[model samples]
Target: MSSNSPADPPVRRIDRVLAFMALGIAVLSVLCFFAIMISTAAGMQHADYATGVWPIVAVLPLVGLPIAFLLIVALLIMSIVRRGKAGRS
Candidate 1:
């Protein structure tokens, strides 16, 4: 007897890529923020932030989080549109 269950929808490559990209950016941003916090807790000087990679570390979460958020929104919209199209067909 043939199974009557509907087949699962295939995940698009773009969706996978966007998801991973958002996750990677969010994780990296959080790690950098934590590193900055740890360094400050350890008595890192203000001047030290200007001299090395600290500036980038401090800025990453500020920028990365918003970008990641936008990417997630885009991914969500894409998913909704894809599902709508599939349902219509």
Candidate 2:
């Protein structure tokens, strides 16, 4: 009967799933970022590159994944929070 509870009707079970998925994406994104960092460091230490472009290309995932992940998480959280608030109202 409360406005904040699931019985509010607007905050569907699907919405909760989506929010958790967003959380998962955020976590996975952070993990991948660390993996890329480690790979980059290993590559640098081993000097196993023939072309100099390997380093540049290898570094792209580090930057791109985190940025995209952050955006996705931000949008997802904002959306879920917005929906939750609207449900309350």
Candidate 3:
């Protein structure tokens, strides 16, 4: 019933952490974006967005998505390096 083969590379903790972090950030960002969209559709004023936590909600997607992209890129690089090393050895 085991699916893993001997040739399969072991998963690293950092990889898992990075992937989860990226996913979580991306999901949260999207949810925030949706919340903004829903609020706007419900007649939220521009002045409201500038106030309090609304600004933070509006900014999260802008900042979070790029960070998630970077995390994904880093994860890819790490996986590639690990695979190359494993293949060579």
Name the best candidate (by lDDT).
3
Model 3 ranges off by over 4 Å: 1-3
What are the root-mean-square deviations of the candidates from the true structure over C-alphas? Answer: 3.6, 5.8, 1.5
Clashing pairs for model 3 are: none
**Model 3: worst 10 consecutive residues (lDDT sum):** 1-10
- Measured by TM-score, the strongest candidate is 3
For all candidates in order, the CA lDDT equals 0.91, 0.61, 0.95
10 residues in a row with least lDDT, candidate 1: 1-10
lDDT of 3 at 8: 62
Query: What is the per-residue lDDT of model 3 for residues 1-89, given as tens digits with 9 covering 90 to 100?
Result: 45477666899899999999999999999999999999999998899888889988999999999999999999999999998998888
Assess the local accuracy of residue 51 in candidate 2 as a C-alpha lDDT between 0 and 100: 62
Write one digit per residue (lDDT tens) for candidate 2, span 58-86: 56555656665666676667666877776
Q: What is the lDDT of candidate 2?
A: 0.61
Each prediction's number of clashing residue pairs: 0, 0, 0
Model 1, 38-62: lDDT tens digits are 9999998889999778889999999
RMSD versus native structure for model 2: 5.8
lDDT of 1: 0.91
